[model samples]
Target: MSVISDNNDFSFKKNERLYHRNEIQELFKKGSSFYLYPFKVIYIADPFEAKVNPQQILISVPKRKFKKAPDRNFIKRQVREAYRQHKILIDPEKLNRNLRIAYIYTSDKKMPSDVLTKKLKKTLERLHQEFTV
Candidate 1:
């Protein structure tokens, strides 16, 4: 697919991350969202920035559910890795717009990497399908 990068490096770079406070607020307040078990995806499509990638994502692990800092960090790390591996499931060109997505882990316990990856794949596919229209 044209959207698949040849690099295959699968590195999650700074540009691919959602960091702005305004953007994050807008995403949760106005974006369309859905939940799939451990993840709740909130996304909004905006005009593409001149040199930015087609998507910027955020991963949130609530401290309320995972009180320990280590637990939260570990879950966030797993989510990031999963997204890094399967991100191309969404065709960038088809979007015609830049997507800002937030994947929030709602579960109170840790999940296996394999299961997390599978769920993330499905989540990405679902995001693609939702925005493709």
Candidate 2:
């Protein structure tokens, strides 16, 4: 794991968010996936080619599982927060590729923030292992 020397490294910036419709579709079509309890993580590592960020991510809480807008929003917030805190676990320099990742909330019920964070941290650590290999 690479050390995050500056506090600014923790910020989740706008460019780090993956929101383009085509890119999202392509991710679902081509990315590899794994289920980690509450989340279904899908990811693609593309050759580096002038990407704005080494890593970009999408977070989704399906409306079918979480009918209310607020519930979906809250879950998304928690997932994003957890990912933001632990993202450094995946070292971009080691991977040498741009990664596009999606964290799809798979659980039917809401999880406590602490539990969610722990799960996400484990998920990220697993991803790091995969990418490095």
Candidate 3:
């Protein structure tokens, strides 16, 4: 297991601040977002000078698709753990600019964890690359 210290702690725990629903809703309304699939990652960045940290990330696997709460929770857990373990995607080096990101899963079914990890890694890499540019 890897320790995600410093800028790599993706858990967004109590010590790390986060954005609120109203803010997200407002961003959604404004639509300054980006999407990469296996999911649609909706991000609303402050069009300002720079950002020291990612405000927050929300993961969604639609309840309408999974239907079973437990199943949905399981997938959500997997996604969060993956992000927690590998948050270089949200690295502050990249955050020399500002951003607020939301990950919304559009898939309609559950896949194994291994498969999910691979996809997540790809998405994170893409986000990292995009973040810098």
Candidate 4:
């Protein structure tokens, strides 16, 4: 067990990432989702099998929205960093099954990193409130 402090000492490990192609497809195909402006979040609670981590997250930047690879990669970094900072808000022990979450970039224009960070926080908070209920 780990205790998350009110500090900036957080890490995003390999286990916490969503990687498998099939899993990503499943998440997109059947997961419940919502949009927060430039971001569209899709999540599935209690995935049938136990995974290596309690939560697995994937961030996607559509090529249509970001024509350049550099732009897409930059946005991906921003999303990952935001999630890493606020992940402490979610406690793994409280949930019985794995939570698979995917963040899809949906806008044509780019927004400031601060705005993305704020929206990511709101997205995570909404996820927490959603499952806790």
How badly does each model clash, as a count of residue pairs? 0, 0, 0, 0
Which 10-residue window of candidate 4 scores lowest in summed lDDT?
46-55
Off by over 4 Å in 3: 1-5, 8-12, 15-19, 31-35, 47-53
RMSD of each: 3.3, 3.4, 3.4, 3.5
| Best candidate (score: lDDT) | 2
Q: Alpha-carbon error at 105 in model 2, in Å? A: 0.3
Kindly indicate the candidate among 1 and 3 with the higher TM-score.
1
Tens-place lDDT per residue, model 1, 24-113, is: 899989999899988988998887665767789999999889889999999999999999999877756556778889999998889999
The lDDT-based order of candidates, best leading, equals: 2, 1, 4, 3
Q: Candidate 1 local accuracy as lDDT? A: 0.87
Model 2: per-residue Cα lDDT over 4-25, one tens digit each: 6654388888998999999999
Clashing pairs in 3: none
Q: What is the TM-score of each candidate against the true structure?
A: 0.89, 0.90, 0.76, 0.86
- Mind giving the per-residue lDDT tens digits that candidate 3 earns over 1-133? 9765655444548423345679668656864545555677766666445434445567778878899989889988888777666666556444554556667777887878788787877777876677667
Give the top-scoring candidate (TM-score). 2
